[model samples]
Target: MAIKKKRQPKTLAAGRPPVFHPRPKSISRKSTKSLINQHHLLEKRKRQAIAKGDKAAETAIEAEIEELGGIERYQQASLQGQRHDRGGDSSKTLMEWFKPCFAEGQAAPDRPLRMLEVGALSTQNVCSKSGHFEIERIDLNSQEEGILQQDFMARPLPRDDTERFDVISLSLVLNFVPDPRERGNMLLRTTQFLCGPERHSSTWSLRDFFPSLFLVLPAPCVANSRYMDEDRLIAIMESLGYAKAASKTTHRLVYYLWRRESKCLGPESPFPKKEIRSGSSRNNFAVVLG
Candidate 1:
């Protein structure tokens, strides 16, 4: 009898995300949920001040962050929050939403798809090992080998369909772009880097199909924002020619898959910062297009 070889399961990545790199011996286990949230809020305020040309406020916030161990320390803390052991890997959910397409035979492994992962935190996530996707990962501050240090806003737009992606993953990225108008512009930019429906056999007509967006936002941005709710978000995406295909919400995050149903916003599309809802406890998070 011939010996049989075992095959590896495709669902899990061959390798796992490593612990935070260059982690100082004295700084081990130094990050907490509250600390991470503080860093996020502080960074957002810094960005807002810089964007508004408020030099004094920007200087003050920079001094405060620097006093609190600087941006590098905050970045390391954020990475700790993303450790696989902490249930911080958002791409796992993206893979779950994608698997059915391959299972149903709509996508083939031989014809591997392309994806752009913005604000990527790891090189060994499940999507990178799927053997069905050629992923291009980028971040503003890349601390790993595979992810490039590049700003998504400054990345050269695809010259043609061959240069565009079948999918785009914008996980936990938009919230960091402090200005609401710029946040809206970033969403508009993704449409340009996506391969349109005509290139694929499946139109964004079906759920979990290619030419789609996997958007992950902090749940509070939708749930507790005075200006935003799930309904308002759906409406904004509609104006940009995408239709919500699926959604899920947890106490910490809100995830959605939006299919590119039509062309994106033109030069003059208008989505202003008008209050749509009111609540005393809500934070101000709005995506404005001007």
Candidate 2:
């Protein structure tokens, strides 16, 4: 009985491989070269397709290229007319360029003034083209070197404990913040920071903040149905002690000159409640903070 028990042989289960398994193919220079060649062929095909106006194929190739380089970098590199030269005008220079927009009764200063520009990069070039005054630029993302990096909603400005700036330019930045209250807060903080604690004390009121502040916003901001209406925007500014001295709309852009006066509150609607006083010979509007 013991001798008969040793006669059975081993067998693999049905549909299963044998106990011995093949090792995986290793990545090698030859394989890598083959892959690269395949990629090049695919790219050539894509180019040919694009030349023929085959949109779907072109899109597929673009997607592949984007995957290789990452979408953001690819977009940044390929986009044309992303940057424009504004002739090296600083904010002060641009102020003069826009000075014709100022209404009568606004004050004009004789000296070079400090200006802060938010969300302005190429516009700074335009500003510089005017050759007026020194301007400091702040942006969320800027390719230009030496500009301050900041997100209006997240980062607070540098606290230098001095009311040093004469002009703060916020152009095309407010609408980016989706919330009206937050937008109002950002504007308030900007004014408060520029005006300093001496001017921003709780008891001091709006007049203590500034004699005049200039604000420019896009017309779409007023017409946007997703956020606060123009009336709400005006109310928020007025509640925070800003009065609209003058506002003008051209095409899709709406420009506002807000004044902080000792006695005047802001307007109740998008319409100007008072005539804006033009300063000097320039048409630029001014807000009297005090």
Candidate 3:
């Protein structure tokens, strides 16, 4: 046993211990500082890209930050506050008040009440929300994108099918048509389309058209592109066999609620007369003599 003695491992120069080796603390500190500097450089570059309006570069940075799970922090730092105000006298407004009254008594729920809108953009949202009707819009130009595809004056209505609608809303449409006769014809045609041939035994007549109609027109007194006085419009409607039930005129627009009648009741028509009422906040008017 005493023939050979084993040798121990070589120790450090300090001779403090053989197992321990002190790390280069400066290297570790330098590496951590490098990482922090790299992060700051990246954020600065992203800001510069955005400031320069380089969309692609900005997108790339956003994507990289998102992948690194820093999207929420980026959004919080970049986003700004927006302000909105929803306060006013809503009741006194004409269209705002008229909508609820029309939706009161109706039949179909599943299949929306079909409406033909003329000279206006797709009134689907307006009609559906206010009157609860599905709008089939027809304008002068091909403007309304999806709802219906056609111009009112340019093309004749498709009469091959017998499908009909419950309501027809001609809002701010007739004024655009220059010819009063054509306007009258358009009004009559609208009624004919809504009341399909199958519904009646005899040929379509203006007297037996729409039971109820909403006509929103501009005042003739106003000097605008499409403005007609109340008397002239009433005469035209009367000629087309529409007896006005209610009418109201504001500063810009005139609204008429008409119904088709069986027979003409002498020359003296029942179209409502306009009455103006002044309000402190806003002017109010009523149609009393229909």
Candidate 4:
């Protein structure tokens, strides 16, 4: 529950995003946490079973997950927890970070910034407010109206300028992926949907704010994982041509704004699984490329 906030300056230094995670005083929080953990554990096991070519094990795991009320139940619980978290929505943090950089309508006089929200829990978050962004929300399972029920990976690749977005949010998403390599692939895939470097708002007040990624993850994924830390995560992002625009760390979450500075070197066979830290209780969270 003690986190050394590495960088809370620039885009996101002052605000505290829901510290509801890791605190066990309330029954609701404990049950939600346990449910999420169970889902994650089962998902990991299913991945492992598939890797070993054990169809029987995979089938059994799927049945177990179904008995636990399936993926829909897990997603609903997550969405509910986000709504109930004491520290408001994650979009609030994303909006705060951009506010300091872009002067709203001034930056884009003709139109609003385009944003793609992956694993979107709701269509009613603060980000959906008019005049700032033309937002598109996508989740694998839709809990409500307006949010597209689709898998981000399977979503059609943009064929023209109209489909690409200025900003893409992977909020509390990448960590949900069971495979580290798949996580890396997912990160790479986002770049393709983002408007190219030419579309970056250079003349705007906060140059290069567009064509950026707003990423949020549970603190443990980076802070306490055996294979990942802030440094490692930054290195991976840098290799993908994203420079750290701003960062903030809370008791339960860490937030980042990765400005897509240079053109990404897409999909190189690099960033293999390497243990950067070792401990008894560290989680096996990693993002391996290729």
The TM-score of candidate 3 is 0.44
Q: Which ten residues in a row have the lowest lDDT in candidate 1?
A: 199-208
Weakest lDDT window of 10 consecutive positions for candidate 2: 78-87
lDDT of 3 by residue, 103-215 (tens): 44632233444556654443334344565555666644444365455666565655643356644677655544433344545666665555432332232331233344677
- lDDT of every model, 2 decimals: 0.80, 0.50, 0.48, 0.82
Clashing pairs in 4: 8-13
Clashing pairs in 3: 220-228, 220-229, 270-290, 272-289, 272-290
Q: Candidate order by TM-score, highest to lowest? A: 4, 1, 2, 3
Query: TM-score for model 1?
Result: 0.82
Error of 4 at 198 (Å): 2.7
Best by TM-score: 4
Compose the digit string of candidate 1's lDDT tens values, residues 1-290: 99999987765454666556774533344445556667778888988898799999999998888877776676676667667666657888888887777665453433568999998888888888787788999988888899999999999988987789888999888987877998999999999998776565443323346688999998999988988888888888888878887788987889998878777654346778878778688889999976
Backbone N/Cα/C clashes per model: 0, 32, 5, 1
Error of model 4, residue 36, in angstroms:
0.7
In model 4, what is the error at residue 97, expressed in angstroms?
A: 0.7
TM-score of each: 0.82, 0.48, 0.44, 0.85
Off by over 4 Å in 4: 1-27, 101-105, 206-208, 267-269
For all predictions, the C-alpha RMSD in Å is 10.0, 21.9, 23.1, 15.0
Candidate 2 deviates by what RMSD? 21.9
